[model samples]
Target: MRSDTAALTTITLPEIRLRVRDAHKLRGYFGELFREHSPLLHNHYEDGTFRQQYPLVQYKVLDGTPTLVGLGEGAALLVELFLRIRELDIDGRHYPVQAKHIEHRTEAIGPVAGLRRYRFETLWMPLNQDNHRQYQTQSAAEQQAQLTRILTNNMLALLKAVGAYASDMPLLLVHLLPGEPVVTQFKNQSMLGFMGEFVANIALPDGVGLGKSVARGFGAVRRVD
Candidate 1:
């Protein structure tokens, strides 16, 4: 049983309303605003190279409000820039910010004793190009099993990103609730995304995004229990 702690910071623009589809635009706005910290903000190098690691800072539009979540070092960076964010410029339109709220927490990243239920507040994309093709050919049960395995892997990746490597890999099971997946557009291409709940024997911080395109806020989860 190994556990590690990381700083988590969430900044929400409560008074500002933005379309969920403009999450990437919010990322772009902040990334350019803080170019010196572009790597931490957008996971891009100054030379325009992509950082091949988990994004510590993620942008999201949850419930029609622009939100920023940062973990570990990124948390500190977000705190540093929180006071500087006064407005948003999206698609040549200006939206002035009025009231903002920020929360900080020290979250545990490790295995848990009991299964915990989590709901995907945002769409969860568990398939890539290769798996997308294979996922369509599988039976319903097989698809669920495949998604379970991928989710377990996703948990491991998140733990590794926070430097919390479990000495003994915990038993991870993702029992997806009965629901139909939604087809969403990502990068102009249609993708299958799931918006439901699952039970896992691990604890994750709220506002943390998982799966692909997490930096753009695709897979945000919150514990229901």
Candidate 2:
């Protein structure tokens, strides 16, 4: 196992009541406002090409409040811009920011002795276009197995992006707690999303996102146990 440390910072506009669906708008607003800072803010290059890297700064709406999470270098960027975020201008509507809460932490990323349970505070999108068709044909048990594999792969990618890579890491288990997967819209296309808790022998910090469209707050998880 490779020992790695990640710096994480979370900023929440506690007084703002933004709908979860408008998270992309938040991304758009900040991406444009701070376009000169770095491409990680919006995951786009100056020439309009997509940066094929893990998104370090992610936008999310947790519990009806606008939340922004930054990891690694992204954490530093958020800290630098923390004080300047005074309000949000979404579609010409001015929403004044009343109060904000920020939390910063450095977490170790590696295998843990025991599994940690985490709940999906936001929807977890596990399938992409190619796999979506296959997922539709699988049995319930097979579907669960496939999703577990995808979740594990997602974790590996996240760890690698954060400078930790463990080829012999312990198995990760995803238990879909008693509910049917919900269909949601992502980038104007319908997609399936899961809402449940997962257990993994990895030390993932709270507010880290997983799976697809995470930059838009698709798979936000918080430690529940």
Best by TM-score: 1
Clashing pairs in 2: none
- Alpha carbon lDDT of residue 211, candidate 2? 92
Pairs in clash, predicted candidate 1:
none
Clashes of each: 0, 0
Q: For model 1, how does the per-residue alpha-carbon lDDT over 8-72 read when each residue is reduced to its tens digit? A: 99999998888887888999999888988648897889788998888999999999989999998
What is the C-alpha RMSD, rounded to one decimal, of candidate 1? 1.4
Instruction: Report how far off residue 124 is in candidate 1 (Å).
Output: 0.5
158-181 in candidate 2: lDDT tens per residue?
888887776676655555552578
Regions of candidate 2 where Cα sits further than 4 Å from its true position: 1-3, 168-178
Show model 1 residue runs off by greater than 4 Å. none
Model 2: how far residue 177 lies from native, Å: 4.2
